[model samples]
Target chain A: MRRSIVNDPDDLVAEALEGLVLSHPTMLELDAEHRYISRKQKARDKVGLVSGGGSGHEPLHSGFVGTGMLDVAVSGAVFASPTALQVLAGTKAADAGRGVVQIVKNYTGDVLNFRIAGEISGDDAIDTEIVLVDDDLASDTGEDDGPGRRGTAATVIVEKICGAAAENGMDLQQVAAVGRTVAQRSRTMSLALAAGTHPGDDEPQFTLDADEVEFGVGIHGERAQRRIPFTGADELIEQLVDPLLEELELGRGTEVLAIVNGLGSAYPLELSLAARALHRRLDTDGITVGRSLVGSYVTSLDMHGVSITLMPLEDELRELWDAPVRTPALTW
Target chain B: MRRSIVNDPDDLVAEALEGLVLSHPTMLELDAEHRYISRKQKARDKVGLVSGGGSGHEPLHSGFVGTGMLDVAVSGAVFASPTALQVLAGTKAADAGRGVVQIVKNYTGDVLNFRIAGEISGDDAIDTEIVLVDDDLASDTGEDDGPGRRGTAATVIVEKICGAAAENGMDLQQVAAVGRTVAQRSRTMSLALAAGTHPGDDEPQFTLDADEVEFGVGIHGERAQRRIPFTGADELIEQLVDPLLEELELGRGTEVLAIVNGLGSAYPLELSLAARALHRRLDTDGITVGRSLVGSYVTSLDMHGVSITLMPLEDELRELWDAPVRTPALTW
Candidate 1:
């Protein structure tokens, strides 16, 4: 049996937003009624950035809001997309004179709601563009007709690079192009030793035996397509990296930005181990890891897992990644 | 059953250090043979700072080793203190021309080894001071003797303040004094929904009934002094705050720096809720929360819990706290 440190499951998202805004009062402000968070001081004459979805994957959309990241972030209930009206409020808030760019994760509900919000924003004379991110290598099916790969940790790379471009006074279309470029090139694969439980639920989303591991998992507490043997950290990371490397077609002398992200319950210790293994493996294959982030940025509600994301580093993307950002979860 | 993403429990610490050093190669360096981490570029004409204990509470001693924090952080195995020889190596490494200050937790083994190391370092004509941190209000016995209180999340505050002072070129005694002031004024209390498991352990340190919470818990996965009925976030915060308020003798018009720290498996959302509750409760008492941090800086493997630490702010201490820091776990 599992328990949560929450009062009411329904109030978790709103309360968390209030708490987060309160924690970073100088850098963030909240529109509580609209259920959105915006920058403490609105930017002017620059393309604004907005991206949000379900609430469970925190520090993702909300935690990414700040000076050099998202201008606005809206929240829906846990694991549920925000309403069209809510997204519209966020997009409107993100609008400076130049226009706004909405970085949407490639989920059906999220994509639909963001599209609707973008269309509605046109009535207010605000130009908007959507950059759909779908980088999960595990969700890649052979058929192009399917929903395509679900977005995962690569969203951070997208929002970060796009945020930097927009901050540098790029037009809406240019920022969208940069975001799309990052999304298209990045690929991620994840594995979980255990699944997460909902806030008030008594049981976990799924169960695994002591000797079994759930391989190729996603961020929304979904089961993996295959189960792999419980093994050493080096071997597990090898399994996740091999497919990504093949999919990215990363050849010798390729330089890439990497992320060893924890899916909620994986601690710094585990992420460090994975990062070390990744660096070793990439060096062996003559792929230089140019820049990397290792932590739980996009999480799955306490799921005990980790994801590896890789994007071939471009000079522009590297500059954007190095740009200063001050947010509640990430800052440099 | 609980399983960790670690192989060969004995190799976990060393491997983790190697991985951490590799991850932040620009800011940190590792002495694998001696099990200590130091700054990539050593500081000159500054008092050196060092802190370390067991390995499980990551991002603690090791993660805080960087430009504005500890000059060196030594590590032992899980829940074990580094040996005197290892600590001597770290102390000697931290010493530049100015001298060194060792920020130690108030644990028997840690205090003993750091003391021995400090004495040994004196033979090299290196002056050293020890700042013992004992901030856990939960373990306060109110006796003239007794082990007093175990240091908890307040170590971060202590390390951060001392690091800033040392960076400003304070003498060894002055730097140690600043750390002691922060440690003395700060107090922390913690409760756990569930205990953390060791790397290869199949069970948690302790079990809590469905409707009970382990209150007054420590960082080593030890049992709490008492069990309290499960309650809402607000009431739990009230229970924790009432005692701290009383203990610190905080008045209605006082200002303080607060930390809402995650013990381990507590996710971002849960911590935000805790932070929200803490802010509301303190505001009601008219206490101005001058500064606050909410995240998992120090952890106990994967224990699902949160800790609250408050130190009444002083102008000099506040300036030091706001000083720029660049470490793996903390940088602003």
Candidate 2:
């Protein structure tokens, strides 16, 4: 298992941090622990948005840390969630005396860690608001009384709009309400024809036959619900839309912000086709898609598949969506 | 070949054009015969900049046809250059009522076609200037003359900075001069571990042994200078950098803008490591890198290789590079 950096496992995070800092020196200011990379100037009189997760998804949590997006991004080891201390440090760094909002995807590990971080943050005068992203409702959230699998790609869009709202002088609680509304409105489902290899590991996390693909896979190589036959892209998208449409009950005159995200290894051509299929299907279903994006916004390493997330638009939500944001992960 | 669209060879361009207009209703306004997608709003008397090339590189010509980069992008067929008619129409669409400058990569087909377009455009009241991108030093450019092969990916950076400059109100002549200066000062070389296949095409344009990589391959699968033994990224960077340094005469106190572009299929991780190697080698050689980028900015389908481009920066050149232009292909 050969990786690019220092031989020591402990040094990997620090070295990667150094590299990230060098690349985005102007936009990012990192503290000594390498725990958090925040915007140089905190948002004065505005709710600070903080997001983080595993380290492998470059430009995801960290790349998104800059103007118009996350105030601070905490880092964990590859495919691992950040600790409470790390998240707390990030929250503290991003706090501008105006409350802090944590965008946590619904992975049990992420939810628990961020919750603890929030508890620790409560000691300060600032308030802490947590918006859990459980847009992927493939499985029961209450299964075994455990936390649901976190699918937070849409959290990026939500954070951007909500961040824009905060940037435009919205109060903390109001901005947070908008964020929660977006998270509730968005839903995503993913499929992978091949799994991504963990760094330093040659073999992929999982494998599939050339003609077969896994449906509803997680970023960490979790298996999906069904193994269906390989067919045209239309069928693949139908599998996704059928379930999603049922959940959203989207109908005529319902405008949606459509996102077709590659899980990694998926080519732009495929992504475009998938986006087109989803768009075509939505149109057939009499759903009005206000905005559609086809690209690798939220990837799962080099997993080969696509995830479609639809965010139903309301007045406030649409305004936030249209607001300007300056983040490395996503840019208008 | 299994292309994505359903149309005749002649109508393929129109179909694709319709798709682009449909997909990006806001950013682009196309003149199909003339291959132009202009910003919907009229320009503010700034220098009008236009760039286009073979059509296979999606989002390159069209995706980049927005606010900060190019004002006009004229696309040809898949891996083919556009006709003079297309180029002229594109010029008309992008002309902003100010003198228009065309940023062309110096391929025989592109040079000839764009030159014809410029000549036709010149006959009109519009002032037309041409900045040919002859940056690829790896291939001989002359029938019996100087330099090497046709212009490759470095054209993107030249287009980006020049577009930025033009948008910042640099006159047509000034923008053309900047484009020409960067094109001359810049040099690019590429190596391919695998050849790319056209959409729906199973066979690759070229092939390499599993353990070998072809160095200095062209965008259309042209043969490279060598196929060396497979090695680690550091060794590969050394191979890429040694040539680039010699070509550019980069040394201590020299500021350079480094672009590590994926020819497709190459993942971001590999690109990152390669950028790391490039930075280290440049630093070891006493060269000061002002900025660095690693991504698939200008790709060749899904070919698996990377190209390294270096532009020696001067005060005026830096200013032009810093200018803010709007286009889809290049952004700040």
Candidate 3:
């Protein structure tokens, strides 16, 4: 039997939203009717920033709906994309006379739904732009074939930088450009020791042997490119970092921001160990780390793994990242 | 066949500490020689706060060290208490002449070690007071035999409130008194759907049947007082909340603060759903929750469960709880 602490699996998303709103009443407002969350105190006449995906990734899109991050987030069910109608409602709620920027991760369902929502918003005379994030090095299919790279934890970095830009009164085009720039510069790869089980499912999406690990695993438990025998932390870090460095074309004297994110069930102790290895490896490679975030920012539901995201930083991007942010999941 | 991404099991705690210091360079300073973490910017002539225990409970003691929480934390090996020598060093590092307050959990080793450290600090002419936290109702030994109760997540609340009091320049006795009051009023009970595995251990600290849950499990994964067949969320909440309410003597119009904390591996989605159920139950019972914090405040390594901590709040306690705090795991 699947063990869970849920009322009805169908009601999990809505109930979680209620809890979030209740805990952060001053910062967030819930539209139960349309199923979206919006900032209680939105900036006037500034471009509104919005992003969302499956509901299981708590504090990702929803935990980020506050003063310095997203203006609105439309949550879907666990490991599922939000409907187009929900995204349209989010755009309407986030609008403040200025245009809205829709940040979409590169997933088939998410891309299609967010695009449809943008079209609807245009028809309603609310100017909207979509910034596609595709930074996953794991799913890299060269240049032409397949569906580009899957968007992973880099979406958090994009939202944060773009949110700061929009809050500083950047126009819609400028904010969207900032998002696109960060997304282009960022790359991520994940390794999983165990797979995550979706709600109402007794078995995991996939299983690994005790001495094995899956490399390049997607956030939704999609099959990875390969599985390898379990090794110590150093070997794993090398496997993740080499590809990321090559993708970013980074070398000695290059300043970059590194994010070591936990995929839900990995303890902070484990994440910290992974981060230590990442920093040491970067130092050995003569890279300069301008800033770093290590924790569970974006997560696959209870998956025991970690993802490394590196964004080669420029002065402008660094300054924007350093700007103050107040959200449930992040504060500085 | 143990599975983990650690350098060496013996070096796990030190490596994790190094990672933490690197991530929060401006806020935390590590004394690896003494096995303690201290604030980079210590407050002069103010009462200092110190707390720690085993290492697996990330963000508990170490993550709580910063401006509005602990001044220093002395970490032991995973799931083991720090030595008296280490605690003495932490006390010395945190002292600012106003004195120091040591917040200790109720486990025998922790209590003894912290007390010995207090005596040694007194010999060094540094005034030190130890506040014993024993809020676990699950391990309550009624009125007589054994230690009063095992400390659990309520230590977070006590540290936060007392740290605020100390930061506001309260004397050592005053700060220690505040911690005592909060501990006296607070009560916690935890339920584990699965047991946690310690580092390097091939087997879990304990085991449970797939369809069974242990109520009142200790943070160290000690066997629970009772086991029952698995039930849905509502029934589990009732089993937890009723005992907590009775222990707290809370009723209609009584103000309280509630924490729905995750044991190590529980997903955020599950924690949020549990928080929602907790709120609805409190409403049905006619209690006024002045403040609330829900997340993984304390954890057993990779345990799949949640703990509920309730503290009947007074206006003073609520004010202290609402004070500004900035730390690795918590910021507001």
Best-matching candidate per DockQ: 1
Instruction: Please give each candidate's TM-score.
Output: 0.99, 0.89, 0.98
From the highest DockQ down, the ranking of the candidates is 1, 3, 2
Clashing pairs in 3: none
Which parts of model 2 are misplaced by more than 4 Å?
A1-14, A123-126, A140-146, A232-235, B1-23, B32-35, B44-47, B96-99, B122-127, B140-147, B168-171, B203-210
State the local distance difference test value for candidate 2. 0.73
lDDT of 2 by residue, B33-110 (tens): 576677776577787878888866665667677666778888887788888888888887778778888888777778
Candidate 3: TM-score of chain A is 0.98
Q: Which stretches of candidate 1 lie over 4 Å from their true place?
A: none
Worst 10 residues of 2 chain A by lDDT: A1-10
B1-332: candidate 3 lDDT, tens digit per residue:
23677778899999999989888889899999988999999878789999999889988899999988899999999999999999999999999988899999999899999999999899999999888899999888887978879999999999999989998888989999999999999999899987888877767777778778999998999898899777777678768888999888898988888888999888877887887778888889898667888788799888888999999998889889989998999888
In TM-score terms, which candidate is top?
1
Interface RMSD of 1: 0.8
| Runs of candidate 3 exceeding 4 Å displacement | none
Error of 2 at A320 (Å): 1.7
- What's the i-RMS of each model? 0.8, 5.5, 1.6
DockQ of 3: 0.70
**Model 1 alpha-carbon miss at residue A199, Å:** 0.5
C-alpha lDDT values of all predictions: 0.91, 0.73, 0.88
